[model samples]
Every structure is written in C-alpha cells, then in structure tokens.
Target: MVVTDENPSAAPVTVPVAPKRRLPGWARSVLWAVGVVAVLSTASYLTGVNTLTSTNTAQIALRLALPILLAGLGGLWSERSGVINIGLEGMMILGTWGAAWGAYHGGVWAGLGAAIVFGALGGLLHAVATVTFNVNHIVSGVAINLLGLGVAKYLSTLIFQPLSGNPRQSPPVPTFDTYSATFLSDWLSGLEQQQRVGISDAAGLLNGLVTGVAPLTMIAILLVPLSYLVLWKTRFGLRLRSCGENPVAAESLGISVYRYKYVAVLISGGLAGMGGAALVLLAGGGGYLENQTNNRGYIGLAAMIFGNWRPGGLLGGAALFGYADGLRLSGGGKAVLALMYGLVLLLVVIVVVQLIRRQWLAAALGVLGAGVLYWIYWANDDLPSDLTPYTAHFVTLIVLAAASQRLRPPRADGARYQSGQR
Candidate 1:
C-alpha cells in the first residue's frame, strides 16, 4: 500500500487519563463519623471531660437512632424501587396512633401489628395513586399526609379521649419491661463502679447501653444488616432496584415492575410504621400524643439522602444524627464546655484559613461559627442546655447544604412507568 501525505502519521492520540481522586461515599461517611468520635473521645480522655462518653449519652444515642434508621430503611426500599414516598411522615403518624390503639386493647405486640397495618394502608393509597392511576408521586404523598393526620386526630377523639378525656393524647399503654439478667446485671453494675485506666466509665457506659434497651431497638439494629442483605445480595432485591433504575428495561427483561414497586412501597410503609411504634415504646410507659413523630419522618428522609441510598451509609448517618441528638438532650458539664470551646477554636481556625483563601461561602460559615462561639462565651459557666436538641438538625442541614451536589437518586425513581411506553 502506498502512503499519501493525506494519510497522516499512524499513531493514536493519547489523552492522559485522570486518576480516581474521589473516595467512595460510604468510606467517606465512615471516616467522617469515626474522626468526629475519635476527636471527642480523645478530648474527653486527655482532659477528663467526661461529657460525650457517658453511658447515659450512649443509651440516648441508640434510642434516638432507632426510629430514624428504621424510617430511612423504609425509604430506601421504596425509592430504590422507583417510587418517591414523601408520605413517610403521614404513615409514621398513623403508626403511632395504631400502636396506641392496639396497646390499649390487646398488647404491645398488637400495637406493633396495628401500626404496620396502618402504614400499609397509607402505602397502598400511595401505590394506587402513583403506580396505578399514574398520579404525581409528590402530590399523592402530600394528600396521604393530610388524610392520615386527619383520620388519626378524629379517631383519637372517639377511642383515646374516652380513656383520658383528652383527645390529643392517649392513655398510658403497656410497655416492654427492661431486660436484666441477675448475673449479667450484677456483674455489669459492679464493673461500672470499679474503673480502670484508659477505660474511664466504660463499664457503666456499656451497662447503660445494653441494660433496659427496648426490644424494638434491638430489632432496628438487626434490620440494618437485614436490609443490606436483602437489597444488595438477593435476586429479588436486584430485580427491584432494576425497576427503579429503568422500569422499561426491567419490563423488557420479564421482571414484573409493578409487583416490585408495590412490594417495595408496602415494605417502606411498614418500616415507617414500625419506627413510630418503636418511638412510642422507647418513651417507656408513656402513651402516644398528638404529633409525637415530631418530624422524625423528615429527619429519616434526610438520613436516607445523607447515606447515599445504601444500608451501611444509612447506619453511619443515623449514628451521627443520633449522637448529636443525644448531646443536645443531655447537656454537658464544665469539662464538656471546655471541649466545646476547643472545638469552636478549631472551627474558627479553619474558617479563618478559608477566609484567607477568599472563599465567600467559607467566610459566611466563619461568621456563623463566630456567632456560635459568642453564644457559648455569653453562657458564662454552663453549657446552653435548651439549645442542644437542635444540634442534630443543624448538623444535618450543614451536611446536606455542603454535599448536595454529591448526592444522586435513582434515575426512574419518581417517573411514571407504563408498560410498553418506554
């Protein structure tokens, strides 16, 4: 073959490939949580702060995480199957009332069953609207929220008010007693009293965490792994996720998209309901009250977003939020205050660096950090207990705001899917 001038050189252009610079979301999440925990724990150990590492705080963190974790799992199931379920709040609210009603008549188990049923009903409504009628998923969810709350409020008047003469709250329901074995309990109690170096109230913390823990809490923790197994390791889970990612392709492949979507949504509702039941049970003999969910459903959704739609990520997100909540609920002592100030100083240094780098957003956050420091300083001696409960919300907001671009959802998640339409 004769080579012509138009033939050019026989060489392939080599564009340099960029190295993989971003870490996996799960690894980043785990590292972030561990770093925070390490920082707090080390501060406590070195300074004898005794603030964040107490048994009471650990127990509270678990208690706070259970509901959010359950709800986040529920959302994962539904959204992973191509349905956007914004009605989780309404479903959870119904679950609370159902739990109270069932406990009032039958028992705690019955209450749990009732909560599931109520949540399932809400899910059914959502499925019918979004899956069958082809209604907008967001609208359907909003309607469910309104309807669920109204139904619960009206039913409370007839069922709960007769018992307590207060339509807004139900009478005390039977609660699960704390589990404490004679030998284990005594040994742990004794261990707590005798502290060792580097451990510092570790026994007491462990005892507080395991003892008196509600059965539902254990179930919630177990569900984390169960969710991971079912969603990531099973054939059924793969099919369900396929439907969410591309329902048309799934339908072409003989997968029943409708069936998977229905199953996912129903399971989602049940999880949210269970979360409500767990919350009431965690209250320890206290009955359900109006608006008892306290926007936890929304918080759970935030956690699902934070977790990047994975079970392991969900666990980390739940723990981070739960720890913040626990801190808020249990105000710290002088040592804790010192640690807080130290953290503030660290934050201020970072913000100042950012300001020097001329990042406008960092400058704004710097102002906010300075405000926080001023507030802490103005408190004089003690930590501001009343404002603590909002730390979880604040942290959640900051994370979401900062990392919104990194978060992605299933492509076909909220789209209407009609067979053969794709």
Candidate 2:
C-alpha cells in the first residue's frame, strides 16, 4: 500500500561530512619556522656572508651537537612516557664524575659503564619521586640539578685537591694522538700551508678538524638513526608512548605503564649520563670541573623541543645550536657576534610562531625584522672582546629554543592515565 508513496518520493539521505579543520596554531608556527630557517640557510650559503668556515664550522657544530642531541633524544623518551625529568643536568654531571673516576681507576670502557650506572640510579630516583610519589616534576628536576652539582663539586675537591693547588695544570686523561699517520700529517700540512696570510693559527684549525672526527663523533652518528628506529619502530617505543599519552588505554591493552615509564626515564638518565661522560672523557680530557656540562643539559632539552620530538629533527636542531656555540667560542668581535646569534634565534622563534599559526605573512615580517636588526648590529665595529663568548652563548640558547619548539610528540605525551579514562 505504501509503494505509491515510496516510488513517488524517495527522500534524499544526506551524509554528514565534517568540514576539514585548519592545522593547529602550533603546527603552523612550526612550518613557518622551518621555512624561515630554510630561507636563511639558503641566503647564507649563496651569499657566503656567514663568517663561519664551512668545513671547520660543520665539524665543530657536530662535535657540540652530537652529545646534546643524544641527551635530548633521551629526554624525548622520558617525557614521551609522561614523566618530566628535570634531572638531566644532574644525571649528566653524575655521569661525568663517574666516568672520570672510573677512568682514573679503571679503563675507559669501565668509566663509561660507571657513568651509565650512575645515570640510571639518578633516573631511578626521579622515577620514584615523580612516578611513585607524584612529586612536582619541575621541583624534582631542580633538586636533582642541585644535588648533582653539589656532589660533583665535593667529589672534585676531594679527588683533585692536590691538582687544584697547581691551578693551571689539571690532571690529564689519556689523550689519543690523532696525527699518527703519514696521511693525516700530510693533510694537516696541506691545510696549514693553504692559508699562509692572516692565518695566525693554522695548527689550531688542523687540530680542531682532526679531533672533531673522533671515536665519540662516530658513535653519536650511529646512535642518531638507531634512536629513531627504536622510538618509532619498536614495541618498547610503542609502550613508552602509550604510557605518556593514555596510560589507562595502554594498561588495559596489557601494557604496564609504570614499568614502561620507569624504563623510559632510566634510559633517558643513562643517555644523558653518557653525554656527560663523552664531554669529560672525549672533549674535556677526563677531568671534573664546575659547570663542566656548560648548560648542555638545558640546551639538550631545547634541542628536544626544536626537533619536535623527532630524532631526525633533533639532529638538525642540535647542529644549528652547535654551530652558533662554535662561533661564539671561536674568538671574534663579541658584540657583533652576539647580535648575530640573537637575531638568528629571534628570527627562528618568530618564524616558528608564524608557521604554527599558518600566518606566512607574520613569519615573513619577522624574518625582515631579524635581518634589519642583524645589519644594524653588524655595522657596529666597537664590540668588546670579552663579551664575544657571552653573546655567542646567548645566540646558541635562542637558536636551540627556536629549533626545539617545532618538535611535537604524540598527542598523549606527558599525561598520566587512570582507569576508565581515555
């Protein structure tokens, strides 16, 4: 009986199709930042206006960036597991001390192992406080940093008290002579001879390059891709991310969130410790000193952010920061150098913010502003010599921050999961 009506009028079924939403502000900002960096890098390379020697600069950048990158990746693991580890600096310091102590008493490998153990202990402490007791992550981190510094200082005084008396001459770690081969010697000789005029220190250049490509550098290179693989392609990584994003979901799915979190935090601590060990053993020649890490832990944190929580991205960010640092350490007009460094950072941040917001116009304006500022500062010829390093340091910090802000972990990062909660 209803066949007449059904045939006469077939009501149209409208399927509700959700409108495509624009990218989040943060995501746009990251894109803008990347664009700006690309533009600037291209300009620098094409113009050859960048004062840095490409070969030496790259080598130096890698040297500094590698250690920090490793530490930052470790931080990524911990934070991704919903555990905020502020104790990275302290862990690194402990590792440095442990490695130095181990090397002094045992062998280099023993020292490295000691650093890892010490670092793991530091991580365990953080895990107990944050995961078990649910302490404020920031406070816990600060405490760890203070504890590390205090312990390191006391230990340094106790062990190197005699050496301290002689101030200039500190105890030496076993330094491997890099220029043992004839080919290496020939290369150095050629480099020295290449720049005959205005080259006051060719030896320094040669030594820096030779030392840059050390065993530690090689190890760090290997670790980068390995880290990427582990974080993205492994079961451990999945568990770690799940714990950070939605612990309840992961737990229901038969994942022990606590165990995963603990493991992640400890592994982070161990990696940071290894970074410290590398700094002292490979870079600083196995000596304990105050502020030996030189804010690298903090930098590593920024690097993690810059990399947008991606291992590959982190390497690039670290390299940029490292290059900025190298320039500062290279001894030039401090004020101008500082200005350049600041400009780089400011530009990077503005670009990042714009990208995140999908405001290309704003990013472009920021780049212009940075360029103007840089030119103004570059024109000033009377910068203080002593202030150069400080300027460079500030620049490096800014760049690192800019680069790190682009990093984005999975949606569930740094959150705790409870039963029945998504």
Candidate 3:
C-alpha cells in the first residue's frame, strides 16, 4: 500500500483494481473497443447526430489521436521504469526537426529512423540527469523542454529558412503512404449509404477506420497490444516495472535497476519522438511547423492518467481526445454541439445512477449539468469557434477530474533511487 513518492509531473497516482475477465488482456481490449463502437453507433442512430459515427470524424480522429497515443505510450514506458518524462513535448520537438531534416535529405523511412534516434538521445540525457546525477526529475524535464524548443528553433533558422524562406518551419517533406481496405470498404460504404439505423451507422464508423490509414498509424495502433505484451507479460517488463514498484526489492532479486531505467526512458523518448513524426508527416499539408506539437505531450500525459496507466486504457483516452479534436476540426461547431447532446445523455445516465444510490447532491448536480448542456444543444446550431477549438482540452480536464480518483500509479514511480541504499 505504500511506495516512495517522487516528483509528480501530473496528478496521476492511484492504482487500478483488476476486474474479472475470462478473456486475455488483449482480447478484452478488443471487446471494449467493439463495445464502444457499438454504443456510438447506437447513439448516433437514436440521436440523429450523424457526426457521432461519420466516416470523416472517425478518419480524422485516428490521424489526430496517433501523436497523443504515442506520447502516452512514451509516458507509460518511462513511468513503468520508475522514471517520469515531463519532457515529452520537448522530445517531440526534437523529433519534428529530425523527421523533417531526414525526410528532406532521404525519405519517409529515413525520417522515422532519424526521429527515433533523436528522441532516444533526449531520453539518454534524461537518464543521465535523473538516474545518474539524481537531479530532480521535474527540473530536468523542464530544462529539456526549453532546450529542445530553443534547439529546434535555432536549427530551423539555420536549415529550413534557406530552403523554405521561413525560420520557424521546415520545407515540405515526403509523408508516409496511406492505404485503404477496399475489400471491406466497398461493402461498408454500400451499407452506410443505405442509412439503415444501426447497420448504417456501424458501417459508416467501420468504413472510416478501414480507409485512408497511413502506415505509421497502423504501427502506432499495433504498439498498444505490443506494449501490453511486452510490459505485462514479459520478464524484461516485469523487471522494468519492478524498478517502478520497489527498486530495492528488484535489486535484491538481481535486477539492474539503473540499466532498466535507462532503457525504459530511452524507449519512452523514441515513442514520443514517433509522435512528433506523426505530427510532421501525417498531420495534413505541413512539415514541422512551429509549435506543432501544441501541448499534445501534456495532453498525452493526461491520457495516460485517464487510462489508469494501461496501454488499452490510454488508447481509449487518446481516441476520445482525438475524436473531440477531429470533430472540431472537421465538423466544426455543429459537430461539437451534436457531440454535446451525447454528453447530455451521458449526464442523464449519471443522474439516474446517482439518484438510485441516494446521492442527492450528486444527482442534483448531474441534473443541473445535463439540463444546461441540453439547453445549449437545443438552442445553439453550433458552438462558438473559440470554444470549439478548446473541445479536446475540455474533455481532457473533465476526464481527469472524473477519473483521477480511481487511478493508482506504480508505488515508487518518480522516486529518486540509489544503488545499495535500501
């Protein structure tokens, strides 16, 4: 019940209570995703809010969610190894520069490789600072963020300015190719066009996921289960997580805590760097724009928290944030307002549950919230553009506030450790 406390970059610290599941973890994750899609399909069918399961929304969500998902996985690796990586944003910045420069000189694959290397280097620096020097993890991470941004800017001025006539941007670079599952897409598209309630909605949603999928997106998606297998099912993962739980115990068991920490943090940086690559290569008509990461690193950290620090959970979290973002970008305020209707229905459910539990005050608040949101949905044709842009952040804050209490992080996460100190 007790673990050493260290610098907390975000407020996530509650451990998760495992529930009964006959299926394997990965299988359960798939079921959960299917269930979510089913619910969304049904919701869209009933509410007549087409954006809920629209192909455009789904496609945009996948693209936007990739970076967040990658960043979250990066957080997972670092935290699971008893280190905290608050410098994910900075790492991503270095990645963008690396990807752009590499793509300019070589190709997309080359850019990916360069991004990973750049990101790993950043992780190595963090390892030296926190693991070796015992520097405060938060301070080290902040410094890295500042340094990364400055370095990227300087590099852009020197390199990209001459080529692109801009100091803060990189020239157009080759992006990863996208492929569609035409085999299924054709059938699904036919079903979707029929507009037949659940059948049509499900088809629409599925079609989005199957079409226009980029290679990096597929790789990033695969990493979710791969992370689960590596971290939850492997001996190396056990030892790495042990460092997070209790390094002293791990050391007594002949685990090299420092080596594992270094490795984990490095992998963390690599994944985050991949996120940066996603932003640069697949983020639509741009190559390493200034501040393109746009605080997604922090949001990804929030997603890790929301997911209770599990790969499947974080994937869901990232998708939720990405959906909100994509809805705003693609559907604009009309879509967001329609989305609010879904939220209102959700609150209505909460109100009923709280009422059943005899939680009078909570039920009342839920009612109030539900009523206000419903009124907004009823009155407004679209959300204000200013507020629409903040949809993802609002979702992040709401999710964290709601889910934070249920989260349980590793016991010794972020703690300063020394060999033979126990």
Q: Which candidate wins on TM-score?
A: 3
Candidate 1: residue 217 Cα off by (Å): 0.9
Residue-level lDDT tens digits of model 1 in 1-422: 23345547765556667787998866886676555555565556655656566667777778888778888888999999999999999999899899888988898889889988998888888998999999999999899888889989999998889899999999999876566555765676676556443344555456666767777877888898898889889999899999999999999999989999999999999999998897776654357889888788878888999888888878878887776777566645454464465466556656877878998787787678767865775586765667555677876896577557688889998999887886
TM-score of each: 0.82, 0.74, 0.90
Off by over 4 Å in 2: 1-51, 162-170, 175-212, 334-361, 391-393, 400-407, 410-412, 416-422
Where does candidate 1 clash, by residue pair? Answer: 328-388
Predictions ranked by lDDT, top down? Answer: 3, 1, 2
lDDT of 2 by residue, 1-422 (tens): 12233555775556667889999755865775565444434433433334343345445666677668767877888888888777898999888888777766776777778888888888888888887777778888889889888877777777756755532222665422232335764566565446432231233234445544656566667887887788778988877787887788788898887788889999999988888877766753556566778778887877777777777667766766776666555535642444364456657777887889999986887787677767756677545766665643565555554445354566765454444555
Candidate structures ordered by TM-score, highest first: 3, 1, 2
Provide the global lDDT of candidate 1 against the true structure: 0.79
Give the per-residue Cα lDDT of candidate 3 at 314. Answer: 96
Q: Lowest summed-lDDT stretch of 10 residues in model 1?
A: 195-204
Q: How many collisions per candidate?
A: 1, 17, 6
Q: Root-mean-square deviation of each candidate, in angstroms? A: 5.3, 7.4, 8.8
Residue-level lDDT tens digits of model 3 in 1-422:
23344856555567667877688867987876676666666667666678888888889999999999999999999999989899999999899889898888898988988888888888899999999999999999899889889989999999999999999898899998889999899999999989887788778878989999988999999999999999999999999999999999999999999999999999999999999999988849358888989999899999999998899899999999999999888778887877777777677778888989999998898888878888988898777877988899999998898786699999998899999988
List candidate 3 segments past 4 Å from native. 1-35, 42-48, 283-286, 354-365
CA-lDDT, candidates in order: 0.79, 0.68, 0.88
Best by lDDT: 3
lDDT of 3: 0.88
